[model samples]
Target: MSLTSRAATSLARQTGRQLAARPAASFQQHRNAANVAGNPNESHAHVTSPFTRGASGRQDTTVIPSFKRYRAGNEQGNKVFQYFMVGAFGGLTALGAKDTVQNFLVNMSASADVLAQAKVEVDLATIPEGKNVIIKWRGKPVFIRHRTADEIKDAENTDWQKLRDPQPDSDRVQKPEWLIMLGVCTHLGCVPIGEAGDFGGWFCPCHGSHYDISGRARKGPAPLNLEIPAYDFAEDNQVVIGT
Candidate 1:
């Protein structure tokens, strides 16, 4: 071989060895860079999309905060609704209790009135003729008289048109022998004395009123006659004053 040809061959062999060493070194460097970048403690920025899933295959990290806010709002709303329900129920109960108390009071008042107006009884055989007997009934005085024949005749013969109240004798008595009336004067609610008036019926000293035997007001300031009590004859000698 010639000197020039040997020199060219040695140069080509050195170039091929260098090229092969460069490829191996470059591959090792790329592998080391990839390992360093994949380390967990490295300060590398992770770019994940908003719609991407997490490790548990659920929604992204933002979903957790949104769910917590929704739960809080629901809890607050539930508390407010509970308070409103309690207030409405209490108001209804109070109204019902008030109505019940008012009804009880009204019923008690009516019962008391009914008990106060109980019936009164009187025996006609105990009363003497030409005399008057005063009895108490319903917190007021009632006058019962066994009228004489002469008194009845005088009462029947009186002129009813000239009297102050103008009531006939026939309307004042259930029986001709008996005359019953209330003792209170029609003028000012004053009680009258029986058989002492100018007309021989009743006299009111407070108002200077007089009544006849038929309970008709004669010379008086009274505008009405003596009132006849509601009475019924249960037997011949017995009478019920109230019905």
Candidate 2:
């Protein structure tokens, strides 16, 4: 045959062979993909699916969108629930604060035992003139004196204006013969000895403070008179130290 015809025949045969091999190559690829998916009859498209599809052709995991699922009428109800929650939290917080304040007040207030000792009552018939009686009231020493005539005269006649703390003896006592004052010294809260100082009243040896017969601060570090407390004579023969 001619050279050109021989060349054309060879070219045709090669094209036919390539065409025949394409289907086999495609089948082999399909078989390989099915084997990888553990099902020889399944298509590669099913095996490579990004998500599993349901019978309705939608992804099995699909859910209705939030905006599409929400209804306009439910908005007020949701807001009301939120407001209720906020108000409940605020109420609880206020209640806790109130309880804390009340508990603090209860703990800081004076106790029953302290309140029970607020006042002391004494009978004058047990005491005599020229004698000093010491008693406790409100956790402090109280000096209750039944003064003699001479002591009362000295206390009233003293020049109170010249003292460090100026006060008349008449102001210190309800009666001229009765003297009631806290024994605690004004300088350093020490207990002073009654009727035992240079002033013949009370003496605080701790700081050398002295008080007169009227419980007036006279010398040394004392800056004020001995504190007088509330008292009443209940009857002609009986005196109540604290009333």
Candidate 3:
């Protein structure tokens, strides 16, 4: 045979051998992939996961697009936020209601100075001699009296035995007979009953307080004299309760 023909024959045999080995190599690669996928109990286990590249040039990486977890977490967070908003709104509404009720539903209160300004006028003809007329002045009870000769004599002649401070010469009273004083008791603010011709003063029923014709507290639980309201006689017989 010729030299070129022998070389061609050798090359042909090599090509045939390579063609037969190609299938065997592919089967071995597939067997390795199958073993990696199925055998979980293997000691040196190499998993053929979707996140890796295979030796056969196959793309094992898979882009799994699923919004299930995101949607579930978002729903749970939305529920929590909704509950928080509802609680906050309820608290604000309750506070607003309380403020409205406090501002508008309660009765208005007046000052003490306004109550102290009330005054009234009394008729001079109504008050008789040796008697007193009760009148309201500056939210307090006042007594206007027309003293008789007997009562005035009794008040002046008595030794002031019923008085707390026994100073007759000190001139607490402006008039000798005519007395105008507050009818309220000095201790606890009770109205005293005006008496005449005996003790010559007012007698309190609550605590048995006694006052002279000049409204000086003479006996009982009262601490001081009955208060005298500021007044001026408008005429010979007319008297005003307040200044």
- lDDT tens string, model 1, 1-243? 899999999999999999999989999999888887887335333644454465544456555333454465477889999999999999999999999999998877746656666678889999889989999888889989899999999999998988767888898888988888888899999998888889888899998999888888887799999899889899989988887
Which predicted model would earn the best lDDT?
1
TM-score of 2: 0.62
lDDT of 2: 0.84
Superposition TM-score, candidate 3 onto the true structure: 0.46
**Best-fitting candidate, scored by TM-score:** 2
Q: Per-residue lDDT of 1-243 in model 2, one digit per residue for the tens?
A: 999999999999999999999999999999887787895334444543334465444455564334544566678899999999999999999999999999999999989998777666678888888899998888788898899999999998999888778888888888898888888899999999987889898889999998888889888998999898887888876766654
For each candidate, what is the lDDT? 0.85, 0.84, 0.72
Residues 27-109, candidate 3, lDDT per residue (tens digit)? 99999888867864472445444444445434454745455766755678899999999999999999999998887755455
Please list the residue runs of candidate 2 whose C-alpha ends up more than 4 Å from where it truly belongs after superposition.
Answer: 1-72, 232-243
**C-alpha lDDT of residue 166 in model 1:** 81
Error of 2 at 187 (Å): 2.8
Give stretches of model 1 more than 4 Å off. Answer: 1-102, 105-117
TM per candidate:
0.57, 0.62, 0.46
